[model samples]
Target: MRHSRILADVGAALRFYSRIPVPAGAAEDAFAPPNLKRIAYAVPLAGAVIGLAGAAILIGAHALGLPNLVAAILAVLTCVLLTGALHEDGLADTADGFGGGASRLRRLEIMRDSRIGSYGACALVFSLLLRVALLDGLLALSPTRAALALIAAASLSRAAGMLLLEFLPPARADGASAAAGQPGADAAVRSALVGALLATLLIVPSTGVGATLMAIGLSVLALFAMTRLSNRLIGGQTGDVAGAVQQLCEIAFLMGVLIYARPH
Candidate 1:
């Protein structure tokens, strides 16, 4: 019963977080609207699933003799496809809203517009470039290590993003963030522990203790910076803000791992 409940939560999380189809019998409530508070513990599991898919492509491309850059690009494309670019869209919208709007109301309105602006376009481009470059660098070091890094980064960044939902009130009363609701403190802690466990198991094995610690520290700093920015700029977090935070933290994690990774 306990194991079944965990599976249900993971299935619900993947259904909520990805474009990947959850078959009808995957779980009893897999298709239901997620209770974000209750299923928060499974967010990292969902991220791990997404990351695993991307890692498969990355390893496959490398096995096919593709250049590291090409392999990294394919891996990133796979992740974007799996999530339907959900967080990417959020990051773009947040960039457009925060960079272009002068007021909180205007910012929320801009985010809701769904139209890509100059800021949004730039953010997307930079985000893609950075991920590809970072992954390429890791791949050049070792494909196995790179795959591990991808999974760890994905899980950790998502856990970091959940902190916003735990700590900040919804910025908009009518949007998805508010409607989906916040996680309880216990739920938040579970999410963090799951993410941290994945990172410790994956990153420490591949990146070494020093690099793994650095990666986690950088991810935390990135999360802190995003939280503060969201609070000061918009008075609280929207879904877009959480998404942007994830993107930033992912990049930061990879950067830390790469910088501190032992000479290969």
Candidate 2:
């Protein structure tokens, strides 16, 4: 890819995935960023940027003499704000629809509703608690290691989401996700490869190669489980399903990292 095309792809991915603003004239510029659906391979690049921002907040808090718990909370909040809780909202809606709906159609209906249900609330609460707790533990090990893990988790989780989009057609005829359409296999593989490379960068440096391989194994398994569960519940996938997969992948990635904790 030309350097210009590469930058535009990153810009498009960043614009789609995060609240961060793109260049002032990216839209009207000659480059004209590619469609999001066509550029799934860039998801990991966008995720790495978001992860770095969150890590900065975490490390900054710790440098300021804050408690690890407090620093972890700050980092979590930073991520939520940076991404506008895009994936988190998707996770909540997916949980509400799948947990409370009586039928497949009903589940799809519930997922599209803007209002949150009891199931959604509970899912959000539980997921947030797990993320915060895990981050706190990771931060205790070392700020740098925790930061790298955040990058890996975010990148790989989004990569997993791309896989969901690649393999499963949209559940509904129309929606943001549906309109984007299913991703091609090559696009999905490229996205996943990017995620793997980034995850390896995070793991191989300090923890060794086994840790890198194990984290990928855990993340891919979680992706498979989530994909199966979504298919069973709704007969297909949706944007919410992608979000849920990202959140689940992040958790699984973190869980794997926790197994090799080394405080420094």
Cα RMSDs, all models: 1.5, 2.2
TM-score to native of every candidate shown: 0.96, 0.94
Over 35-132, each residue of candidate 1 has an lDDT whose tens digit, in order, gives 88878989998899999999999999999999999999999999999999999999999999999999999998999998999999999999999999
Model 2 lDDT per residue over 161-250, tens place: 999988787888888777777778888899999999999988789666776777788889989998888888888899899998998888
Q: Where is model 2 more than 4 Å wrong at Cα?
A: 24-37
Q: Output candidate 2 Cα RMSD.
A: 2.2
- Residue 126 of candidate 2: its Cα lDDT? 81
lDDT score for candidate 2 against the true structure: 0.85
The weakest ten consecutive residues by lDDT in model 2 span 24-33
Clash pairs, candidate 2, are none
